[model samples]
Target chain A: MRTWTWLHKWSSLVCTLFMLLLCLTGLPLIFHHEIGELLGTEAHAPEMAADAPRVSLDRVMEVARARHPGKGGMFASQERDDDRVWYVTLSDTPTSETDLKQVAVDARSGEILTEPQLDNGFMYIMFSLHVNLFAGLPGMLFLGFMGLLLLVSLVSGAVLYAPFMRKLEFGSVRRERSPRVKWLDLHNLLGIVTLVWFFVVGFTGVLNTGADLLVQHWQNNQLAQMVAPYRGQPPLTRLGSLEAAVSAARAARPDMAVSFVAFPGTSFSSPHHYGIFMHGDSALTSRLLVPVLVDATTAQVTDTRELPWYFSALLISRPLHFGDYGGRPMQIIWALLDVLTIIVLVSGLYLWLRKHRAGAAKEAA
Target chain B: MSARRPLPHHGGRAHRHGRAHRHRPLWRWPVRLGVVTLVGLLSALLADGFWDVVSWLALGALVAVCVFFGWLRRG
Candidate 1:
């Protein structure tokens, strides 16, 4: 018990300030899309017939290539909520990450609607801060480590809660007691109530930090094996029909919809095959995606497989952290939980500093 | 502000009313439920259409937690 107390105290002290920053930044991020739309930077697809015959995927690729001139299509993804639009991303090279651009294409007409203005504005600033503290991977990893400390603190705090509340009730907030006691009760009640939320978000948040590492692993392992047969083959100058490739992938995974497609030589695809990522329509299955490999030169379906468990976990963690999956209501719930977390952090800090001050005064006496 | 102060008597902290309710369930089970709720809510994000039940359940649980805290605060 003493060890648990020490753990809780030090762990909370170490990461309270950082967690406060995350909770603050994450609040606005929960509504970033709505905020973006209000800011007039939202890219909307032109309304079309609900059952209209859409243009071919190959035509969409052609339009994207024409718009970018020398660049190549890295990825194309349909909007999850709106089927009318498809986002096509292009870069200087298919594999390049820097200066990458995206175009929202009218799925029916194959015309560029608007270039989504992202990675700027106040939301972007908040996103960067919440994500990496403007320090990129190292910053993300540091926060992930802090998240670990937060988990330790939560566990330790829970351990202490039993003893502290042994003689008291579960949710007791002693308003008549010292201010610190009142805050402590409030903190414990809120913390325990939101324990599941804070832990899940923090855990998944840490998993998301491994996103770059996961992509790197997929590139070296699974992608390497899938494209091994074409090792000596030169990159195809004239790509086969994306429409045919997509059809072949659809044939492979009939129940699932094509969520995104990574063209040859892109980060998500190999040099010889197009990565057709298919996903289920259900809320749970939607997060799990399976990639189908199609021969770029022949547009022939090669192989399809469910991603390894860890990678699938990473896929699930993304939306879990963002709280955008269940619509506005879920985000609202997430925001409320975030507020509770803020109270926990602040009260924990206050308790520690107050304890230190009391100890110092006693020493002087 | 003393750590040595006695526990509160009113509100959510007053669990010592009856002798019958004093049974101590293992802390491991509550800890386990916390873990399940955590995973359930997170996995809720992946759901859509008919699978929205999980998401809804997760939301309901969170809402309940908030309401409980509100009641505690009010008391």
Candidate 2:
């Protein structure tokens, strides 16, 4: 019991502040699309006929490239809910991770809709603080460590609950008692209530923190092997038609829809292939991406393979952490749970502070 | 009389032991709620429509429990 108490106190104290920040930032992120729509930053393609002739992928790429004269294409993707618009991302080089631009093009008319701002917005700030604290990969890993501590704190706290609640019934607050006792009961009640939720979210968030590392590993392993035949070939001066490449990928996986296209030389693709990712229509399989490597010059499907177990796990962890799987009701429930978690964190901190002050005063006396 | 004397003492001990045994399962409610929460978290991710509704109700139950104890049921 004493060891569990010590573990709980130290671990909660170490990570409580970061967990609070995450809870606060994560609340708004649950409604990112809704908020984007309200802010008028979300682009919507004008309504077209159901059988309207859609513009070619090549035209969309051309329009996106025209917006940025010298930048190279990194990725072209559509929003999960809105397939009518293709968001083309460009950077200094194909593999550069910074100073990127996004241009939204209408899928049917090939018209420029908007250049959605990637930085300096309310949601952007929330996302940066929630994910990395604006310090990039190091910040991400630091938070992941904090998440680990949070798990330790949760386990220890659960252990301590057995002792604390031995006398009282479950959900008994004893509000007539002292403030400390009331808050302590509240802490236990709310903490245990949110325990499983907090654990799932924290565990998945920690996994998501290693996203860059996982992608790099995938690139060096499966991706490298897939493009082994064209390993030493010089980069193509003129890439093949984007339309033909996507068509080849679709023909290869007739049951799946194209999720995104990672251009040649990007981190997601090899130097000589277009990594066209395909996804299923179901809720679960949609998160699992199947990569189809197409030769950039010939527009021929070179290789196709399902992602490894670790990669699939990482992909599945995303929706569990984000709470975006269900619709508005789920988002609302997620926000409410987040608020409850905040209360738990604050009450826990208060209990620790009060105990410390009481201990100090007794010693002085 | 001597044999009967232990009877009362033994009954008292048994009664006390029964209460303690009930309290011993401290994990009862927490584990049950944890299972419900686990089901809720996974159901929505697996499918839509009916499963999503199940998820909402399961998770919403926890929030309802908190509100009932923390605010509605006051001393």
Candidate 3:
């Protein structure tokens, strides 16, 4: 019991401030899409006829390349729900994560709709802080460590729940008592109520922080073997028909549709293949993306492989962490839980401060 | 001043343990099931189309938990 209390106190105290930051930033991120639309920051394609002939994938890439000179095409993706607009991303090199650009093109006419500068703005700041504190990989790993501490705190707090609630009912909030006791009861009640949620989100968020490492490991192992045939071959300077590549991928996985085309020379693809990512239509299965590697020169489907179990776990973690899967209403629920978490954190900090002051007073006496 | 008796610290722990054991077993399964239900509901939220039912049911339970807490706050 003593050990549990000590663990809970120290763990919660250490991670509370960070957790509060996450919860607050996460609240706005939950509605990021909606908020983006509201702020007129998101691009909307001009409405074309229902049966309008969509431009070829080749034309879309041409428009993207023309707009961002010297930038190589990284990814071109169409919205799963909306079919009228195709979003194309370009970077300095195919592998560049930063120093990138996005262009929204009308699928029908191949006209450029909008090019949202993604590097700056309020949302980006929040996203950076919530993601890596703007320090990139090291920051992400640090936050992941904090998430582990948060998990430890949750477990310890739950362990102490029964003992603390021994004399009280499950939802008992003793308002007639002192402020400290009242807040303590509220803290315990809310903490226990959101126990499973905090655990799931925390665990998944931790997994997500290691995303780059997981992708790198896969690239070094299974991906290296799959793309070995292209070894010693010169990298393709001019890519073949993306339409054929997409068709080949669709034929490989007839049930799935292409989510994005990862161009050659990127981390997602080999030097000579277009890594066409295919996803299912359903919400749950959509996260489980399958990569179909097609030769950039021939547009022939070289190999298609389902991601490993860990990748699926990683995929599932994405939605579970964001709470963006169930639509707007689910985001609302996630936001509510986030607010509750903030309260729990604040009350925890308050409790610790009160105890510290009390200790100081006793020592002074 | 009256002579003070040294009360044993073990008494409080023992009494708390007894209380926990009595009600712990009773509420154990329900809490376990509730956690399962909550997890399922969260997973359901990620699902779309035909799988949305799971999300709705889970959301209903969570909202009820919130209302119950609200009522307590008011009381």
Q: Alpha carbon lDDT of residue A318, candidate 2?
A: 95
For model 3, the stretches where C-alpha displacement exceeds 4 angstroms are A49-51, B1-21, B25-33, B36-47, B50-53, B70-75
For model 3 chain A, the run of ten residues with the poorest summed lDDT: A162-171
- Tens digits of lDDT, candidate 3, B1-75: 111222334588886776666777535743864675565565564656555556655654654564476344555
* Model 1 docking tier (incorrect/acceptable/medium/high): acceptable
- The sequence of per-residue lDDT tens digits that candidate 1 reaches over residues A1-365 is 77888899899889889899999999998997788689866667666669999999888878877887888888989866676788898888886857787888888988888777545669878988898998989999999889999999988888787767766665568878898888878777777777877887888888887788987898788878877788888768878888899999999899988889998888678888899999887776877889999998788888787888878879878887888787766778779878878988898888888889999999999
- Give the TM-score of chain A in candidate 1: 0.94
A33-76 per-residue lDDT for model 2 (tens digits): 89999998888888788778879999999999899999878999
DockQ winner among the candidates? 2
What is candidate 3's lDDT per residue for A1-365, written digit by digit as tens? Answer: 78888999999988888898898888888988787888777778776678999888899889988998999889988776677888899999887878899999888999998886678887888898898999999999999999999999999888778677766766778887899988888888777777787788898999999999998988887788889988999767788998788888889899997788899998889989999988898776776789899999898999888788877789878877887677666778778777877888898899889989999999999
Greater lDDT among 1 and 2 belongs to 2
lDDT of 1 at A221: 87
TM-score of chain A of each: 0.94, 0.98, 0.97
Every model's DockQ: 0.29, 0.35, 0.23
Q: Highest lDDT: which candidate?
A: 2
Candidate 1 Cα deviation (angstroms), residue B62: 4.1
DockQ, Cα level, model 2? 0.35
Task: Provide the lDDT at A37 for model 1.
Answer: 82
